[model samples]
Target: MAVTQVKVDATEARLAAIPAPDKGAAWIEAARDAARARLREMGLPGRRDEYWKFTRPDSLTAPEAPAAALFEMGEPQVFDGFDRVKLVFVDGVFDADSSDDPALAGVEIERLATAAQTDIHWARETYGILEARGQTPVPRPLAALNTACAGDGVLIRATARAEKPISLIYRHESKTSDAYLHHVIRVESGAELTLLENGPAAARFNKVMEVDIADGGRFNHVRAQGRDHERRAATHIFARLGAEAVFKSFTMTVNGQMTRNECVVEMAGDDAVAHVAGAAMGDGDFHDDDTVFVTHDAERCESRQVFKKVLRGGAVGVFQGKILVKAGAQKTDGYQISQSLLLDGDSQFLAKPELEIYADDVVCSHGSTTGAIDADTLYYLRSRGLPKAEATDLLVLSFLAEAVEEIEDDALRNEVTARLGAWLARRRG
Candidate 1:
């Protein structure tokens, strides 16, 4: 195949226009410099890039934020009943007046911007390191851009089991705010922490989160990307797991004009387990994409990718997931499934599932399916005297239950379910 070379003049100009990172600690400045160099070489992804072919990058790469009206939040917040340490950001800047103190018994938390102004910390080593490591095989220039320019986020280290979950809540009050944020999390050996995020941060957002799990550590992440009809965002999560570590992440997205979520996992130690799942719903000019990559480099590691999207009224959904098992990583177990339910004929779903294994004793499977609601099942629900809209919503919830079930915490799962239900109710009304 002949390779097509893209013109770099425009891309180079955009990279040059991005403001340099604010002066910080020496190590942070060094890291940003390295990331900026890498991003310049790789350039921003365009329509021709194989990985970004399904979704256009125009909205995401624009110099100014696409016009997005601030959405009035109506439904009860996710995890309303839970007692947790809250860190709040308004327009992508840390709001200390609205947020709790960054002090927890078992976990040490600091604002990345504040920490960079003080002495060196552990986050200096972790910030953007995994994103740098994930640059091979495929380049993630958006993540690299975030690493180079992000102005605010949090750094968390867990030394013991956390007494309560930590919540990062974002509020979008500006119509043209462009926000870039990066978060680094480290779960030490035998430590556990649950991280929760809920927000519509800005009109345009770029985010990167890097997590490092030591031996026997466990990390749970659950997020609900907020409902804003004109918002656009590109977010990436890079994680590396040590021996016997556990990593689980789940996300629910509703009503964004464009959202692209990329999750990359490297199982670098034996007996480690990782699972990532998402359930998204879109209606009328909405576009949502979930791209995930998992690599197994150690023996007896397990990984799974599950995603489901419901689209209606010309909405577009895309899923691209792959699992790779390296040579000599015997007994690797991998599973992946991406499915979509199109409520109307005009809606569309695109999926690409791949599995590449070099080990002989590995068990790997992947599948993708796109279809409308089951006619028979719809009929059964309608026969029970449910309205057509209610019946359809019921079926949608049933289709998403599999992905939602991956959330291990019962209360959090219920909260997510309620949020989904509320979204459906609003749509039906």
Candidate 2:
């Protein structure tokens, strides 16, 4: 559980040299300054950092140059069923040419930078709000580095009971460069909103997303992160729920040199509910990590988490999930499950499921399983005259079907399934 103090000390010293924020762009400057100040206070996570024990952060060393704000944006491929609205970011900058929102009634979707300048209420409530939650002493510098330099993100505020879904896409065309992005989402009370966020390949791209839901609101988020073979990416999503608020999240990860998706959901208000499902497919030298931390801080909250991973070649997969119930969180119900399939001897998987309970009246359970293809089942299928490879592929699809089914949008689910097939084929070859 010991940490590398040398790296932590070096990172803190580097952050201390950054100059203060300029008077102009005060909010962004403030955010960056806050990040630097917090850097000295935070260190890389150690083995003792229970939340990050599985996914080691010491491997990620900060790049030399600071993240840039100006970069060329390329034409983005639009989704067919996403007629509600679209906002695109390329190389961490908002691209106007690729954004579209149906001029519908009773809805408002805008950019975070513009909102910061004009809308006081919106800016005050959500702008750079993720930092207020504070940071733990995780050895990973991406979180702090992301806070230090992040571009504006798309903001959506659907009024009470939204009628349509909202979609946002961020593309990284900088095949040889690195980028960082930050996004904040706020859903008002009694409203219903669906969102899709996509990312392209880059040498490196780190993203942090914070979503806040008011009482009686419903937010359904679907995230897809697919980058090039040599690219590295990490995403952190934190959601805070209010009384009677409902949050459903579905994540699909495929094709990355090294990618990790970390989700933290807090039921801070009574009667809140959260449902989360995620799927990751890794091939070649790719590494995909999906971790979840759900906390029940109020009474009568319910949550369910399901994660599935498929690995091939020398690929590696990791899943760490935990559910915690506070002292007064009576009647809390939380469940978590993680499953993985290693197709070859070179493939590997690490899974950890933990539960921390302080309240006497709560229900929580977690389970994890990591194993190779079931030989008995495979033999049965091969005995029926199916080829070995074909039988394995079929079994893989069947194993991953549960997580894919969680995607309520069938079209999107099919698209992700196609991507999964492509990744598997490459590994087989």
Against the true structure, whose lDDT is highest?
1
What TM-score, to 2 decimals, does candidate 2 have? 0.86
Q: Considering every candidate listed, which one attains the maximal TM-score?
A: 1
Candidate 1: RMSD to truth: 1.8
Any runs in candidate 2 off by more than 4 Å, and if so which? 1-5, 12-28, 44-52, 64-81, 101-104, 119-121, 134-141, 383-385, 425-429
lDDT of 1 by residue, 1-429 (tens): 222245255456556666765689888888888998888778778788899989998888766667888877765677767889999989888999999887788899988888877656898778879999998788888999899998789999999999899999888977646888899999999999999998889998899999999999999999999587888999999999999999999999998999999999999999999999999999989999999999999999999999999999999999999998999889999999999999989999999998999999999999899988899999999999999899999999999999999999999999999899989998878
For residues 128-206, could you state the per-residue lDDT of candidate 2 as single tens digits? 4554452432233456666676656666676766666666676656543655666777788888888877766345677
Pairs with steric clashes in candidate 2: 44-138, 44-139, 45-138, 45-139, 161-191
lDDT (Cα atoms) of all candidates against the true structure: 0.90, 0.71
Counting clashing residue pairs in each candidate, in order, gives: 0, 5
